[model samples]
Target chain A: MIRTAISAMLLASAAPALAEIHSVAPGEGAQERLQEALILAEPGDEIVLAAGRYELTDGLSLDVDGVTVRGAGMDGTVLDFTTQAGAGEGLLVTSDNVTLRDFAMENPKGDGIKSKGADNIVYYRIRVTWTRGPHPENGAYAIYPVESTGVLVDGVKVTGASDAGIYVGQSDRITVRNSIAEANVAGIEIENSRNALVEHNIATRNTGGILVFDLPDLPVMGGGNVIVANNLVVANDTANFAPPGNIVAGVRRGTGIMVMANEDVLIENNILSGNPTAPVMVIAYVQPYDDERYNPLPRGVVVGQNTFDGGGYDPQLEGGEMLKAAFGGELPPVMWDGLGSLYVTGDAPGWSLNLTEQGKGLGAAQPAPLAAPAPEAEFDRTGIGAPAELEARLSR
Target chain B: MKFGTASLLAASLLLAGTVIARATPPPEQYVNDAAIMDGGLPRLLSDYGFFADAPAQEPVPEVHPYRLNTPLYSDGADKFRFIYRPAGAQISASGEGLLDIPVGSALIKTFAFGEGKDRRLIETRVLLHRADGWLALPYLWNEEQTDARLAVAGARIDLTTPRGEAISYRVPNKNQCKECHGLDREVVPIGPKARNLSGDWLEQMVAAGHIDRMPQGADRLPLWEHRGKSSVEDAARAYLDVNCAHCHRPGATASNSGLDLRWEQDDARALGIMKRPTAAGRGAGNLLFDVVPGDPDASILLHRMIVNEPGVAMPELGKATVDEEGVEAVRKWIAGMEPR
Candidate 1:
């Protein structure tokens, strides 16, 4: 009886169908194998992968609706693109109602798992990794889902990447649950997405944890997210794990949450303790003045009722004198409030208003040119070797 | 870069380095000052404060007499050991407030002068409901500063929703009011002196037959009815008679934080720091969410219950007892301090 009930629950919870991958044996030619699989894949048809490693030369695109490609396991099946040159989008899935589960797609010259213009394309138990050697000219992303909808990523593990562990962009009705995203420049970043739910996931020991950002001017603005619950969002202590350049210096200093231009996003009931610097950060939303993707808001954000305990360190200072010294000789004060508990929602009146002409609910207007004091042409070689002696000192 | 001699030498050196690294202690590995001084301050205060305020102070005429006239609330069908009765038990600074409160409830014990030098006031514990839920009077006194009080503005109420789910809320005001007052299932409010009846003037009145004896203690005075978290209602009685009876019972600190947590043991109406959270800032709730019924560890109030940091810690006075054992006791008390 117990077995029957368990099976019934599994059946009820299990998605409509299984996603499979086409076989790419070690002895087979990589091009023929992938091309043949792409040709045979129809809408909703799965191509199951057999155990072995296959090296790719050019990028592969699957634009069919409901087409799924799955693998044996991350370590079991390897899509090695070590020798590929100028390849585009390693495993591109651009269709709706599709699913990709249990796979390893590694070291592409371009986006690791890039999917565009699709809906309900779920990726489950997928492991996307990189090779240390020949480190393809560009093996950047682990899993990149852009301009998609209803993307649920569960039990997926990503490792050793220069970019986000899982980057989901401009989608709605998405859920990323029970996954481990660590050791990447940024883990589980949601850019221009709405109504996204991130729960039961361990996003710890990463460069950055769960960021809700809006990349404006690209015709996208994120709003209404639920960073409902999770734990152990600590500092990315690994030195080599730091992002190239000061890609994110101030508001992005090791935050469990980096809240940008968004609204009505609830960050509640999560253990936001422990992180070298801040466990939570609410960055200034100044569009076209500071950041390129700033959508200056009419209202502020909510920093509500969450407990913050330790991992105590904040290099950023509130006093004008301190900020000047930290960011060269003279710079605008980037002091953030509403950190400890119960910060306001929708444009805190306490903070200075940075309203745009359009933000006054006037007719639409062009986004101001990014006034970000131009990024450094050459990113300084990150201190990839110096481990923070301070980080080694903290723990509870 | 080679495959033989140079690589072998580098690998050997790396191995040797690993071995040497393990052999020596890093600078941080050595014992630091923090390791030794952690539980120091909080410990001495608890010990020193306990002794100085023990039946040792000059006896006041009458502290909290309600504990002598009330019956201890027993948990059963109703779930709560007590019930609430508004207007039945009320007190204020003007000395013109309602009395005749039933046993087992918490009430408002506001204090301030109507116009007299008679500074000492009545013990408070019966409860009432208004825009805020059940309000309590929490005023803790340090041994060194008896006149000083750490009163809080908070509300405590019991609400059974239309769905038949009973929810208790304790809205905290400006300060971290939930901390020190929280112990047992109910916040163990500090009495006028030490957390007992020997220090109360009302108990003296009861001893002198001015009022009826509450169903508690060896002499039915309200203190001896202690049974850990179970009989904390009596403890709650002992709490109010001394703490709020002086100030909030009539006149005191602007009713600092505007909360009165004094429920007579006889009345046992749920008191201060017990009610639903209120929205403070623009959509920001003053109470941390996730106060699920039956599970105290997940409650945000429990966090304040165990916390001891300055602005975040409870009582906001005399720093909580920080001995590993004492802190643990506080933690255990808070973890168990869910609405009974």
Candidate 2:
């Protein structure tokens, strides 16, 4: 401890302007002490939390820009909010250029580690869990970053969220990679966002895995330019436990790599296994919206090469038994609602509902074998991830 | 930078004139300008000297009391509001927007329960306008009601609210204060918008020379006490503007929800009329739209307001119990709407 403090002092003196470390430990008054450090921290300061369980009551927040809040490790330093009394989230970050890593929050009454309107934020090596596993009353989102530019969520694990785990909404230049989203309603959902790169994430045991969507009547609209690649999407057949009135409550249980109401989306290089429903589902927004600015179609979506194994064995469609029997005891891998511009490459067997327009129910479907054309050109790969400068903060 | 320097020089010149005109030594009622301008956090509420008698909730000389047309409900706790401007500084107005108080000003609000001899101060929330921006802090009152101390992470008091419900009243933490006061990534004052301030109070400030003139949109919101004399829509909109607009407007905390309830917003969709929920997870309560015309029970906007749970509640902070009166006003307005 003495050596660490001495080195921190040396670093502070060397910089003379930035790099001040405020170290806090868990004990009585841990809530006040840690929250005070977060509130009073200056720009470029680091608030280091020692390894222990912080039994906090209310929510904590950090609004100082360019600050770093680090803990010993995800398991070593746990922020236990089992008795959280008030506030919307366990930890709220409303400032820019903030880095939070190596910590865990358990059983918050609301969300866990929400960063709203906080730009260039990096959340690394963090873990958020309900501890009681899947339940309807769990917080909405874990590791949520919304309405921000340049968001990077790397090496995080989220479980038992009633809504999406690692949910990024209405943001641009985002990357969510090297994460584990398990037992949540929707694992790793990118909604109402643009220029996102979701790669190399392990998404399993959730209701749906890796959803790229665009909903209407949001401040930031027209979500597109997404790349969902190189991930493990398997066994996402968990029953949807989302609360009533949530949009995620409508998600099918065994969906994998679904895209809705978006354009220029590329889904490729994923390992899909053990998913009972369709391995890849592409469709449009089903709800009728009054916003004129909204186009409820998935245009220019490309489904590339992926390894599908043992999926669609027990389908969750409207007529599962008849459809599966007609398809030789197991349904095809890809399922489309037949309302969008979908292109598939490399000859993946699939089927389509052949819906005529948006907001049509299953009664309007004419189910048939899917036939889609190859893409005219390669998918655009420009500016499709978090800014490269965000990775530098993780190294520190 | 140049404007700041010039303003400082002008303020100092005005201060010199006041010093020369004074007959006796300035009383101890003077506000501590250093405390407001200091970068360090004041440990105790008394350190800022905002109140002459901290227990009695009495303000110092430059601290002036003001009342809004319709006030926000905080578990029915009676609020004492005050605005403190430096002796030489001046406040300017801009239509119905926020009054541009000088950088050294502060807004102080104290929450108390009970009346007369039974009154007990619960907490005090202060907004200090430093050079950088507004800084909000919460202070928890002691059991003796002598002075409140800074509760940086906030505290919960197991006390009975005005409605006789035994509840844990929450004192919002420093960052939670920013949740309601934040605008466009900056902490700002939310209550002193010109439309919400009473017209008589504006004219009084103008007569006192603290303000240049009465703002254009002064006294537009329906008065809370006289809501029966006004339209139900005006009363409900005033209640929502006072309570929800701080976070629901554009560039605020709930701005991503696409519901802007500010008084000046005339568009029906922008006001959450038949607008679908965006990020209102379980708060939507199985309702389809935010405001369902002619169906108060089906409106998600009213549904969130009446609930007191953490994740499901609107305003998300500073409220524990249902504001039944506020709910009734909104219910009447929604019920009166013409259904499409």
Candidate 3:
């Protein structure tokens, strides 16, 4: 008993004396008070919100590093932007080592939660939604993190987004787990990102579920080493409401899993059901882009041991006429564009499709090389490098 | 008793006049509520003492004033006056072509509508240069027209324009002010570039001792709408430079698109001619290219500028309605361009 008391006294003395908690209640000028609290918070400080509805007109921003913004509960503390006057994201975070938890942001004019260029961020039990349901006028993204690293999004619920419900763009080292995305155009999209693991998430009633894409003209290109496994992708039959010109606008209505213009991707052990068109689709980025530095090919894809059910009943022909003609209105379980490499060096063809463990579905159509072989040219082994090299390049 | 009261009132008026006539002191280095209030700056919207002794509207109104070569169009509201006050010393030029003003400087812009007694004052945005960094403070005027108070979280005012059109004006919060004013997430001034400060304005600033020297051979930006003052191409480029270049430039938030809309950009692809958008979504309007040389209808730039939907707008902030004049200018420029 004497030793325990002595250790407790020592621990109390070692704790920082400046740590503080600021609690805010909903009232007039509550938004301003919250903004002031965020601006005045120091490192390791916590700003807590009471259980009530707070009406906000303008978006809030936080740039103080290592601060925690918490609420009473996700269902209890509500930040409603139904009458927002300003544009831009609802909560813009530009600081490192920040944690946002236990709050609900609804019906912002733009993105619901956006973190830009920040690292070591965590979002826990946060919900973003449009209360008016799915519409084209909804915000673009519900939970968005761009150009960030070491991001963890856990136990989040998102819905009613015109674009992707959970979008991680041009980022690295991201893990999105235990999240639910519903009634969005593209649910849980990972675009131009690397070293991402999306698992244990429920994506339902969206236009497309769990898309991994690498488009041209972005600062960070060539996404690789993405693992999409152990997720429930079901009944993504919502109509595509995304505006044109975005790559997601071309996403078919009932696609369960899509991989485009990326390499070193593994899609395994996911339960995909009730998607009318296809369970898995892989294709190239065939859009015309002027940037010469971008590579628009899907390479080194591995599909293994996924349980699929109730697909290939009705397909959306706008996905492509080729697939419709090939399947005659009932699409396959796994589909590939079958467009081989344009540059025909003596290298092992730019990429390979390993379908070793795939079972009881229409097999992928591996396209033959279109270009003639050049035996005298040196072999270009750049595209077929080891996974470790790809991971290192992505980490940088 | 009446004679005694008259004499007492006369004495107080004399003392108040003496205080008002004295030279105003410079503003403090850092802006706080108490400091600004104690400094005795103009509190009312029509005080007419902070800038010049004359009325609000004039050709060259106020002290040490400058204007952007091509101003950003905020809804349909007009910025009748743009002025600046250097705290202690002149602004020095930086190597990156940005003006590095001293810590105590303040950039003041007043947004107003109409003229004379029917005029309505909207809001004034003050960008105060502080010791730590620049601070954005927005002051909203009350309906009594007596004084304005600092609004940190912004306000929404419903008013009718002189043309009898209704508008809901929104004053940006402190954080939203940093959206366009910041570069690489650091809050800095976006205006006062060498290109925007050339010609007679540079000569005048030099004469008034606001800046040490004028940059020579600096490229000047063309005015957006001055009644045929500049060519169509110049107007279009200037509009894009002011509206989109703040985010679309290199290393900016929208730089992932690879479209650089800065005034100094020369590459065709970077200029968005026949260039595909990176991730425009519905903002693309099903258009193939960002800017198709000879077709304005097929251009994504024009489509985004004309639309006001949540995911379709170009600027992505501070505007709920489209600027028809800006859209017409860009349309005319695209229509006149020769096919490449």
Candidate 4:
């Protein structure tokens, strides 16, 4: 009993504490108020927001580090900017060590949530929506992280983007986990960045899903990212078939994720399933053939241990033949419902294709500051971990 | 009286000569096939209307074998290719149907085509070479077969000169055959199936009194093997409706804003271009003006319909499984539409 008490004290000492905010609504220049609080805040100050919609035509950028702005609930604190009467982003951040929870940063004339040069950012139970209830058009990205570092996107729901949902570009030491991105041109785009940990994120119903892209022959080289244990895709099976041009043109390719000329990327412990066409795609456009002259061409992508669920060209239509003729022998299938290890159907009871890290050393990694030496395992998946006890503990 | 007769005869002779020269041969001013289909893949899909159920050209087969023989024996021309069009058009090929794919993989067809010793085999592979996925071609990016068995087969490729000289290219080992009938990415349009009946091929025959418009609504005569709803003309229209409607609608890339390309055309205001927005991106398909009040030449759509850039072709579907005559049909229609 004495040892247990002493260990608890030690445990408390190792962790940075949390701050909490109760209520702040309308008449509160919520902007000015937030700014003031941030200035007064130290490390781990929590600003719990009241249930209401906050509009910032010019948006708000966090000034302090280690400050968190939380909401009462994900669906409750609605921040809309689609028809925003301003010309700036909804919310932009420049400080690191910030945590946001139970809030929805939505619809901006510019980017939804633009984090510039920030890092170690975490969002808990946050829903960033650009879809206008049912009619969304050109609703840009949900979480836009550019030139930042150490971003942790947790339990965040994002949708409806003209471009991408969770766009991480030119960043490092990042982990985007336990989030949902759908109805965007591209979902979870990691471009010209490095050292990212992408897992437990569900990207569906877009022209292209989670992508690691670099324009070959261009000066930029996006490399060295780890995409472990995330559901990178789904078929854009929709009952709502709007008019042909409802969702704009140029967005048609659907998939779970992609690795385009990105080197040293790890795609493990994830389920890539039910994409209308391909689950994961790797594209490398080189010089001479491609018009854009690259100073240096893109190469090196190592894909392994991930399950590519049932996906492929529509067999009912005529796309199958075209697919085969283009890739030569590389064109295999667009679907994999039973390739066991990595893929699972959401329709299945309790996610039939769960992760099997039974004998591995990483002990079922979470989306925290994932520091580890990954074991040389044979398979990788895009499925999230369901550590019930841990989840329960974290929620509390 | 004799002078009048001579003058009349001379005028008639001059008219006949002009017509003969125009019909004789294509001028050297014509470029190659590589200059026709450019842009990217999305344009190809939109231009063709790939999703909407339209009448099929071929009669519906009573039974389709799980494993087809068409893609299996390429007669030495066994490879996959990607054909792209300007933004929002594409045709993809993979390892199924004609070529056996791995199981859950796909490849986007490009100008640089793929070749395989065995189109249907999925294991023990070697990637020998890579080509420009976006090579220029006339009509839809053009390629052909050059293998012995296929040459022996009855695959007819007609090569003709302006002087009516004919050379038949063999369809044994060349580009994948299903180009005209696209294999992936929504629908296939802009390919070889279009080579015939373009310009005056069918029209000249009709004008020569070989055929006439039926007194009824449409002449439901059997043409090729493909089958579905509607007459041949209606089916062709349906093919256009399904393959191109997506982008041709208002506020889309193909949208002259006020010009709808669905089954029922939309008014100019409905199509969006009372004053169209400038194409936003640098490499965008937003060609400035499509209907310069009355001039089709001033129209961006017309310019795109007959393109030469691999990066900006209209109906970007390269000849993955079909042909370029389909694009010609669209071009003919676009050239003839009267402004509202």
Best by TM-score: 2
Worst lDDT run of 10 residues, candidate 1 chain A, spans: A367-376
RMSD of 3: 9.8
TM-scores of the models, in the order given: 0.41, 0.92, 0.79, 0.42
Winner by DockQ between candidate 3 and candidate 2: 2
Tens digits of per-residue lDDT for model 3, A51-137: 999998777888788788889778989999887766667898878878898999999878898888878788888999988777877
Tens digits of per-residue lDDT, candidate 4, A269-316, equal: 567666654554443322122213332222333344566555444422
On lDDT, the candidate that comes out on top is 2
Proportion of native contacts found in each model? 0.00, 0.57, 0.47, 0.00
Ranked candidates (TM-score, high to low):
2, 3, 4, 1
TM-score of predicted chain A against the true chain A, for each candidate: 0.70, 0.96, 0.81, 0.68
Candidate 2 vs candidate 3: which has greater TM-score?
2
DockQ of predicted model 4: 0.01
- Rank the models by DockQ, top first: 2, 3, 4, 1
In candidate 4, stretches whose alpha carbon ends up further than 4 angstroms from where it belongs are: A1-23, A35-44, A133-137, A216-220, A237-252, A286-298, A315-321, A324-331, A334-396, B1-340
lDDT of 1 by residue, B122-210 (tens): 11122222232322333323334333232232222243322234433222221122122322212332332212323243333334333
True contacts kept of 4: 0.00
Off by over 4 Å in 1: A1-24, A133-138, A238-253, A286-294, A298-300, A304-307, A314-396, B1-340
Find the candidate with the highest DockQ and give its number: 2
Over the stretch A1-396, how does candidate 2's per-residue lDDT look in tens digits? 654575577566755244678999999999889998998787778999999999998889998988899999999999999998788889999999999999999998889989999999999999999999998888899888999999999999999998888899999999999999999999999999999999999999999998999998888999999999999999999998887677888888898889999999998999998778888999999887788999899999998999999658888788999988888898889989999799998988888989997995788888888898999998989999999999977767
Count of backbone clashes for each model?
72, 0, 4, 137
